[model samples]
Target: GLKGPENWGMIEELASVLGAATACSKPVSDIGWRPHSEHVGQTGKPVAANLYIAVGISGAIQHIAGINSSKVKVVINNDPEAPFFKVADYGIVGDAFDVVPRLIEKLKEFKANNA
Candidate 1:
């Protein structure tokens, strides 16, 4: 529900800075916010990344099944009771709008310090 079309740019930026591939829930693709090729879930593409970060996904069973092979899973959502948390190595309970920007800032800071 939090996958605002307006936020796509920031999301793409997040993926770029993280050196991560971008994928989305079935609904996001179904609604045409993203291409079907970018959809990942039981009914879509399966992912086996070393690290997977799911933002704003509510963790439907199908979605979890597809990403289960990921070595590490992190979930960000506003709902503390979101099912994704059950399988996540780390979970952040907050609005994506607020949490994502802060996360990006922190990552950039860490990158600068380590560089």
Candidate 2:
């Protein structure tokens, strides 16, 4: 599940900037933190996106199964040994709270410079 809904604003902003659709693990949707429509997993909606960015998700087998079709997978979690890292094309080990803000800033900077 995600760290908390408080940081979802920045997460959504970043996804918007990247033109990416947001999805979440089943638990997130089950807990009513995110809409079930946004849930992606074996029992949820299937994702075949070009890129999947998973944040704060522990990457259960069911969760990973849904996203296996993605061309690229990026995982950001505080746990270095998270199962998600095993399958991620790129893995960042850190707190999403600390990392997401910096990532949003960098993405904004890149967009400003490129635009």
Candidate 3:
């Protein structure tokens, strides 16, 4: 589970760089780490994005239900048994701290090269 608000900065940065919107789990919003408007779950907002990347969020039934409409789902988590893997199009089992920064750097490099 996420320790604090500091962990979200990288996630927000990645989302910004990817031109993707950032959303959090119900627990994160409830803990005041994110606004309710940014929460995604059956009890929160529903997601229908073409690409959805979930970081450090274990899939709850409610959360999965909301994002089920997304065309593609990618999950990044340390837990190999996270339920999110069941529905994800791709899964990266690793520490978000270690993975996200590298992913952002690679995406930035790819964008620059492709541009």
Top candidate on TM-score is 3
Tens-place lDDT digits, model 2, residues 1-115: 3467776787798698889878888988888888999999999999988989998999999999999999999999999999999999999999888888889889889989999
TM-score per candidate: 0.96, 0.94, 0.97
Give the clash count for model 1: 0
Give Cα distance to truth, residue 74, candidate 2, Å.
0.3
lDDT for every model?
Answer: 0.91, 0.89, 0.93
Candidate 3 steric clashes: 0
Give me the displacement of residue 46 in model 2, in angstroms: 0.8
Model 3 has an lDDT value of 0.93
Q: What is the lDDT of candidate 1?
A: 0.91
lDDT score of residue 108 within candidate 2? 86
Cα deviation at 20, candidate 1, in Å, is: 1.1
Which candidate comes out best when scored by lDDT? 3
Which portions of model 1 miss their true places by more than 4 Å? none
lDDT digits (tens) for residues 17-49 of candidate 3:
899989999999998999999999999999999
Model 2 residue 89 CA deviation (Å) reads 0.2
